[model samples]
Each structure stands twice: as structure tokens, then as C-alpha cells.
Target: MSADDKYPEESGRRRFVKGVVGGATLAGLGVAGTVSVQSLTSASGIGGGPVEAMTIDRTGGPAPYGMPQVPIEIDDEGYIRGVWPEVDTEEVQGVEVEIAREELGGLQYSQEWFQYCGHQSYEGLDPNFDSDNYFKSDSAPGYDWQADVKDEGDRFHIDDFDDYEEWGNDVGNSGVGKPATATWRSEDTDNVIPVVIIRSSRMEEAAQESEWLDASTDEGVFAFVNKCTHFCCVPGYKRTGESARYNAEDRVYCQCHQSVYDPFNIVSTLYIALPRPQD
Candidate 1:
């Protein structure tokens, strides 16, 4: 058959392949099937009788459906490396991220999903991320954690750190209980996005004993890519025998060159390569 005869349009073929392969990939990784934005039942259908005087199965009042909830955890390295109740992708529409630092009292980062709700014009956005800048580890060396993230689809996106300089914030805010607002200017396009921040400390608590909406064993499946932004190296965390927890006295060990970072302020270039400068 001719190419045009077999495929009437380019999108016709691409759409078919995307649909078939997407499900296969998700299933192989044990990811729950994606949910749609459709509603299950109507509120008006409840609370009425069948016949003139029959209460039949309609003997009900106002009721709500409680969807099953799942628990997940975040590790010391600041990763949510665990399974979770599949969330509605529409939820990608609105996400609240809370990142707390220093005994859950310092740096409260919050970004309501409402900002990115409607369609946006991404013209001139930098998809290449070449113009993006990294906040040197020395600037915020008080804590050290890594969050490595990757995805097959556009499920994840990055923001340039330069855009948020006015707010006095930076990335690497994914540590245990340190919440910092993340700003990324799309390299491929001209768009800036914001997300709520929550770090790994809460995960430790959730792991010890599950409670509240944030506690879940499966949530632990995810982990943050905490490598040094410059050399792409991993930093060590404070062990039990360390000087003290989350204090400058405690340091984040860099294996590449025995470099130690104070976990209470910004990082320092005592021995290893220097970290990128913060805005």
C-alpha cells in the first residue's frame, strides 16, 4: 500500500504509537494507569425513593466518595523513592509544595497551582537552559542533599535560577525540611514556573511511623538528585556520630576531594572545586 494510503496523516500514526507504547512503559515500571478528568457520578442522582412510597436502595442523604490513599517516604538523600496512589494528571494542574528548613521553622516556600492553571504563551522561552544559572553550593552549604529526577515525557520541567533573584531564593532547597521556592525560565521557551517546596525530613518521620496525608511507605520510592550542580557529584550526609545535626559543625562530605560543606550556611571551596555563585 502507498505510504499516504496506509497513513492518512502524520499525527494519525504518531497518536496510535504514543497511546500503545505509553501504557506499556508505565505498566512495566509499575506506575498506576493515568487517570482522566471525568467525574464518576452526579450529585443530583442521590437521595430519592423508587416507587410512590418505596425507599428501595435510595435511602440515602448527602454522601461523599473517599478514594483510597497511599503512603510514601522520602529518604535522607531527599528522594521520594517509593510507590504512591496514582494521582490524577489533572492534579498536575494544581500542586502545593511546602519546604521547611531548620527545625521546620526556616524558609517556608509555597507556590499555589493557581498561577499556571490557564494556557500560557511560551514564546521566547529558553528550552536549551543554556542561559540558566546555578546557585553555588557555598551560598547555602548549611545543608546538603541530592534530588535526581528524570522522566520519559514532559512530566517534568526545569527552571532557570536567575529569574527568582528578586525573591532571595535558590534551588538545592530539596533537603530534609528546608522549603525554598524554585524558579525556572524555560530554556526552550519564555515561561517561568513556580512550585511549592517540601524536603526530606518529613519523609524520615513518615518512615518511622505513618500518619497524616504526607506519610506513606510507597512515597519513599522517589529520591532527589542531590549531586553538585557543577561536577555532578554526590555530597555525603551527617551520620549519627557526626558533630551535630543540621549545624555548621556538621558537614556534607564530598567524596571527590574530601571537601566538607557546612550544613548551616552556604557551601565552601576549601579543597574541591568551587560551587557556582548564587545571585
Candidate 2:
């Protein structure tokens, strides 16, 4: 099915949101609100939410899927060794690395599935459930649920789908219409950071207004933390006019409470307003 068919119209979005709210209440959980930076980092999980043990597809046999080594060289001290426009030297204490288009094709896109009906199972949620294996470590032998995310991108391309046409078709179990994400280790802090990259043709206006340093020069690559400023639920990207929460244009949307953010604008004002309930 096309994205239009998969993602409902505005009215349909209202129903979906309503269903989600009702389901959460039934499950004895409340919607999360704004959160602090400290709390966000400490959560160590996806969007400061609980981590669930997910099953892996050991059947396919593990293919090579980990942080690919980039041209950005890291020194023995773990600092990036070159100067690039994409990196903030002050932040990383080394040369900033710029992610090239070719590199993006090799990187794995992050996926997320929402099943608000309380029906819990790996099936019907994710197609490439094993794509998230990178989040898990050998020492920790389970799915790192916290690792699945779609929020910010640094010198990274953010879009509704990781590979627009491919993901739109739901190939490789790519969570089409779901938030697509990628991650890299910052040479500066030596921390693995998740980012959302947008290359949508329709997001020019929003990108011009974003906080991304290179938004002006780059093709709308703005990176930020994947956590929602409010309550920290992993917000997913919705294509322009896909749902009621994103009635006008493309945006980052929080399923928890229907909070909508502009993918093009700075994160501070991205939260334009809350979606109004249908009367």
C-alpha cells in the first residue's frame, strides 16, 4: 500500500490518536509530558520509555550491521582526526566529520512500530526486527529496545523514510511511515549519538528555519537528540499532510500525546501547538 493508504487522513489520524490514548489508559499508563536533559540522558532507553525484550531473527544469520567505519578518522584517544564542516570542533574537540551521500546508503535506518491495541508481539510490528541488533551488545543478550529512535540529525539527512522510495514501499521491513533514524559515535565525547536526517523536497521552508548549523548550506540536514523535549517519548517523523497531527506539512510527531513539532524549525519552537480534539 502507498503511504497515503497506510497513513490515514486528518480525520483518520484523530481516530488513531484517540485509540492510542484510550489504549494507553487501559494499559494503566499515562501520557508523558516535557522532560529535562538529565532525565533524558539517564533513561538510556528509547525516548525515556521502558525497554522490552524483543526477539531477534537469528534465522537469517547475522549480516554485517554495526557502525560502519567512516572516513572520519578517530585517534587513539578516540577523537576525530580531521576537519570537516559537519563537525562542531568545540563539541568533539576534533575535526568535524561530514557524512556523505554514499555513506548514508550503507547506514541502517532505525525503525519503530506502534501497536496501541495492547496486542503485543514482534509480528505485525516490524519487518526487519533484527535491524535493531546494533543497539544490543554481546554482554547484553537481548534486543536493546531503547536503541530504536528517530529524532535529530547532525550533518545527517532527516526524512520521513530512510530511503524515500524503498522505505515507502515497506521493503526490508523498513518501518515505512515510521520514524527512520541513524546513529554515529561523536569523536568529541565518544558517545554514540542518534540522528534524524531529512532530505524531503517539501521541507525546505522548515529546514531554513531549523537550528541545524549547516541547514543553510546543506540540503536540510538538522540533527538533535531523538528524545522529545516534552516527556521524552521517541517522536516519529510524519510526511507532509499524512495525519491530523501533521495536517499542513511534514513534521516530527509524538504518539504519546499528539504533540507536533516542525522538522524544519529549531527544536525550541518546533512544538507549535497541540493537536485539538475533534468535537
Model 1 weakest 10-residue run by lDDT = 54-63
For each of the candidates, the C-alpha root-mean-square deviation to the true structure, in angstroms, is: 25.3, 17.0
Query: Model 1 over residues 1-279: C-alpha lDDT tens digits?
Result: 243231123223545644544564455233111111111121221111111110001011110111011122444543332221222222212422121111111211111111111101222111112432211122222222212332111221123111222322232232333322222332343343322222333444544553332322223221221332212344443422322222312334334322244322211111111111111
lDDT of 2 by residue, 1-279 (tens): 234232334434645655554564343322223222322343222222221211111111011011111122223433221112121111112322221112122221111111112111222122222122111111211112213332232222222224443343211123222233544333222233333443443344443453322222233223333444333455555533333433422455555544555544331111111111111
Q: What's the TM-score of every candidate structure?
A: 0.20, 0.31
TM-score for model 2?
Answer: 0.31
Report clashes for each candidate as comma-separated counts. 65, 21
The best candidate by TM-score is 2
Measured on C-alpha atoms, candidate 2 has an lDDT of 0.29
